[model samples]
Target: MNKKEKSLLAAVVVGVGVAVFKYFTDRPKKQSIKSLFYLNDFSSISKNFSKEEIEREILKIYKEEINLDDKFKAILFLTMIEGIESLEKYNQMAQETLEEYVKQSSKKFLRINKKKKTGRNIYRENFYDLIEATCEPSSLKADIKLGIEECLNGNFKKGQDIFLSSTNSDKNTFVSLVICYFSDELEKLDKSAHKRHVKNALKDDKFLFLKSYIMDKNNMYKEQIDLLNSIEPQNELQENLRLQHLLINLIKTSDIENKNVNLVNEMIESFLSKKHETTNTVLNIIGISIEWSIINENIDFVKKISDMYLQGDIDTYVDCRLYVFTYLIVNFVEKLSEKNKQNFNFMHLNTDKVEILRKGIENNETYYKLYVYLGGETKDISVYKKALDICITKNEFINIMRILLVTETQNKILQSNK
Candidate 1:
C-alpha cells in the first residue's frame, strides 16, 4: 500500500477520528437527507439535474420517511437544505418567502404542543395502559362505622387486590398483605402454585421500609425493628425516604415495645391491604347491603355477594383466585336469589363444593385465566384441581381452569390406552 493510505489505516485502528469524507470510501456519497431539490446552485449539484430531479430529492428529506441512527447527520442535512431553500426563496421574493416559512412552522409547532397538553394521544393509547374501575362489596370500617350496625360486607378479595396493585415505596406493606393473604389461600392447595409470587414479593426492594412504616402506625415497634433490620440501605437516608426511617426509629423507642405482637401483626396486615379512596368508593355503592348483613345477619347478603363474585375481576387482588373461593364459601350459605339459588346447588359447599371440584378433575383445565397465568404450569390434574378446593375465596375461576385440563389429559390418556 502507499504510505498515505497506510497512515490512514493506522489512524483508524488507534481510534483517532478522521473527517467523515476521509473515513468513508466508495461506500456511498454522504448527501443531505433532503435529496429532492438542489438547494445548492442547481447547476452545481449536477449539470444534468433538471428542476424535477432537485424537487424529488428535496421531497425525500422533507418527509423523513426513513429513520436515521446518526441524528447529527440528519441535522446537518436539514440545516443545509434549509439554508439553500431560504436563499433561493429570498432571491425570488423576500417578503412572501419569509411570511410563508414563518406561518407554516408556527402553526405546526403550536398544533403539536396543544395535542400533547390535552393528552389526546391517539398513537399511544392501548389496553396495556388503560385503567379500569374495580368493585368489591365486602370489606370493613371504610364502608361501615365503629357502632354495632348490621353491615353486610361485599368482597374481601378486592380488598386484597387494592393491597397488591400498589407498587410505590410507601405501599410496600400494603402490597405484602395482598400477597400474604392470597399466598395463604393458594398454599392451602399446593405451595408450588404461589411460591414464585411469594418469593418475588419478599425480595422486593422497598418492602422493608414500607413494612416498618406500617408497624410504626400500628404501634408495633418490635416489628418495626425487625423490618428495619431486614433493610440494607445505601449511604444516608434519602430525603424522600426519610419518613420510613424515622417511623422505624420511633417504634424502637416507644414504651411497651416489647409486648404487642398480636396488635402489631393486625396493624401490619391492615396497613398493607387497604386503600382509602377506593374502599370508600366501593362502599358508597354497596355499603347498605354489606353493612345490613353484618348488623342483622340477613340471608340476602348471599345474592349481593354472588353477583359480585361473577362480575368481579380478580386482578384487583394480585390476580388471586382465593378471593373468589372465599367469597363463594360465604355466599354459598348466606342466601341467594331465585336464579342463583337454582344454580347455587353448591350453597352448602361444606359438603358439596369440594366434591364438585373433585369431580371436575375429570374435566380439569376448564377453570379460568387466573390459573393459567398465576398457577405456573402443570400437566397432572391432581395438583391443578387441588389448587382450586383450598384457595380461600372465589377460587372458582382457577379451579375451573384446573378442572378443564382434565379434558386434555383424558384425551392423552385415551390415546395411550388405544
Candidate 2:
C-alpha cells in the first residue's frame, strides 16, 4: 500500500487503456482497406471513400500482388469501372511493367532457343495466353459492369464494343455482345468470323438459351438439333435446352408459306406437350414462338395460347402477358365466336392481373408499341396521344412509328366512313 506501488499500478492501467483505445480506433480503418482486396470488392467502392482514396487503396493492393498476371488483372478491373478516367494512370503503369516483363522474359527465352525469330512468335502467343486465356473467367464480369451502364443508356453498340475490346473477354461478354448483334446495334462484320465467334461463345453451358435463340434467328435449326442430339443432357437445364431446340425446329420447318393448318396444329401440340415450368427463358421462347404463329395466321396456335392464358399457365411471366395481349387485341378477339368472345372477356375481369399488365406497359419499352397499337384498336385518340408523349420522352423510334401508323390509319378510316 506504499505510494510508489500505487503510482506504478496507475501507470500500468493507463498504458493498457491507451493500447485498447488505439486498437479499437485503428481496427475499422485497417478492415476498410483489407475488405477491398478482390476485384469484385473494388468494383463496389463505397461512397464513404473519396475517388482518390479508392485509387490509392486499389494501387496499394495492386502493388502487393507481386506477379505480372495479378497486377494486370487488377489494373484491368480499374479500367472497367465506368467514367473513371483518373485510374488510367494505373493502366499506363501496368502497361509499362508488362512491356518490361515481356522484354526480360523474351531475352531469357531467346538465350535457350534454337530459332530466335520463331521463338518471338511463340513468346507473343504465351503473352496473349498469360493475359487472357489463363485469367479467371469472372475477370470479364468487371467489363460487364461498365457495359451495363451503356446498355441502360440504349447505347448497345458502345456496350458491345466495350465487351469485344476487352482482352479478358469471357462467356458473359460474348453473350452480351450476341444480344447487341441481334438488336442490329453492332456494325456489320465478316459473317463467317461472327459465326465462329458465336460457336465459341455457345460452348459455354450457361448460355444454352442464347444458343437456341441464335439457331432460330439464323434458320440453322437442323444444325442446332444435331448438336443438341449429340450431347446427352447432364441436368434439367440442359433438358430444357433440348426441348426448346425441338420446339424451335418444329416452328422453323413448318409449311407456313402455304398456310398449312395441320402443321400449325402440330406446332401448337408440340409446344403444349412439354408442361414447361415457366422460366424466364422458356417464357421468352413461348412469347416469340406464339408471335411467329400469329404473324403466320396460325389460328389454332392462337387458340392454344389463349387457352393457356385463361388457365393461368403463363399469367406470371411478362413476355407471355405481352404477347398474349398482342394476340388477343390484334388477331384473336375480333375473330372469336360469341361464346369464345365471352370467355375472352373474362381475362379483363382480373383487376390484379390488369394492374400487372399496366405496370409492365409503364416499365418496359418493348410493351409501349403494343400498348399504342391496342389503343389504336380502341379508336382512342387520347391513348394515342399518351403513347406518343411517352415515346417522345423516351426517344423510342419504333413506338413512335406504331403510334403514328395506328393514328393515321384510324383517321383515314374515319374519314372514309364520314
Mind giving the per-residue lDDT tens digits that candidate 1 earns over 1-418? Answer: 9999999899896665445546686466645424312232322433444444544554444345333212222222333333355445423332332333333323222111111122122112111011111112133223221111110011333434444334451334334423443342322324553444444444544334433434454455665566565555443222113333443354346345544333333333333243322232222223323333434444444344444432333323321233334343444354645664464433334434343333333232323333432233344455545444323233333344424443343333233324
TM-score of each model, in listed order: 0.18, 0.46
- How many residue pairs collide in each prediction? 55, 0
Give me the candidate number with maximum TM-score. Answer: 2
User: Candidates' lDDT values, in order?
Assistant: 0.36, 0.51
Residue 150, candidate 2: Cα error in Å is: 3.2
lDDT tens digits by residue: candidate 2, 378-404 = 666666555443331123433454344
